[model samples]
Target: MDTAKVVATFSVGIAATLTATALQVGKPSGWDELATGLLFAAFLAAIVVVVFDRLTDANHGNLIQLAFVHGWTQERLLKELQAATIAAVDANSWVLTAVRISTVAQVGISTLSGIVAVVSLLT
Candidate 1:
């Protein structure tokens, strides 16, 4: 999750740089415009991923805190902890899947944007 956040942050920076360069090229061709749009989209997507991951982490932390607060007896606390563990596993699985999909999307869009930018420059 931390790695995903780091990569997403890096991707956003790259996307911004690419978009700025595309805009500065002056009198962009259709391909340059397309590259800029795709870079913007990629940047937005990375931001969303980072936000969603942070939210999910906060929610899980709250859940764990609630479990400790509510559990009265030793047995109850153990049970609560076990339940929290299961829930965490499920949530982490889903989060990992989402991160994987978003990472693939970011990479694909960034690659395509780079290609289009290069083509625009060459033509």
Candidate 2:
């Protein structure tokens, strides 16, 4: 089994379990509530990334094949593709930055939220 896929699946399973527990327990502390929201957002972001990546992969393969058929050198094709604009941002950076930022934010906020939730529960 792919380790990364297994870990991702585990992460999602944990999130779902926590969500269900949170719903069944009475009103959660603010920290718990925030954590749940962030987890939900993180899941949504994952879905969006998967969809966008699949869409781009389709275009990426086609572009490479087209370039090959036209006798364009790999290096030149890569340079042009990297410099190309997608949604007004550099093709290479736009989606990547978005996906990275969201993932980082999700992880950071989730950690912070977890800490706060633990403290709140202890107090």
Candidate 3:
């Protein structure tokens, strides 16, 4: 929960801020409307996923921590990691998901901004 909240809080805040700004100042037509809709949807999804992830982590992380601390010895940790590869998987999932999502959103914004700029120029 803490980890997810740590990630989600800032992300949601940023998305809310960006979508709100886009809604206010975005171009009136052409691709702007579509861009606005997609941005707003993504913002909403970010909020939802952030909340869900935090709730999920809050419930699971504690148990995992406890298991690691008391139930698992160093040898066991090594064996478990070797067998299930959980830690590596979690790290990889977190890193990849964050990077991929951010990259996609960046590209989306750049594309929409380019569309708006071109349309603005033509108009």
Tens-digit lDDT track of model 1 for 1-123: 678777877765776676567667768789878988888887877776776573222244565576678766767656666776777677678777888788778767877777777677667
lDDT of each: 0.72, 0.54, 0.50
Runs of candidate 3 exceeding 4 Å displacement: 1-27, 45-106
Candidate that beats the other on lDDT, 2 or 3, i.e. the better one: 2
The residue-by-residue lDDT of candidate 2 on 1-123, one tens digit each, is 133234334454565555555545566677567667766765665454444441232246656777888988989788656644352344445666665565555454445444544544554
Residue 81 lDDT, candidate 3, scale 0-100:
45
Sort the predicted structures by lDDT, highest score first. 1, 2, 3
Residue 80 of model 3 has an lDDT of: 51
All candidates: CA RMSD (Å): 3.9, 6.5, 7.3
The best candidate by lDDT is: 1
What is the Cα-based lDDT of residue 48 in candidate 1? 64
Regions of candidate 1 where Cα sits further than 4 Å from its true position: 54-76
> For model 3, how does the per-residue alpha-carbon lDDT over 46-103 read when each residue is reduced to its tens digit?
4544544421122344545756778877676555545455555665576556645654
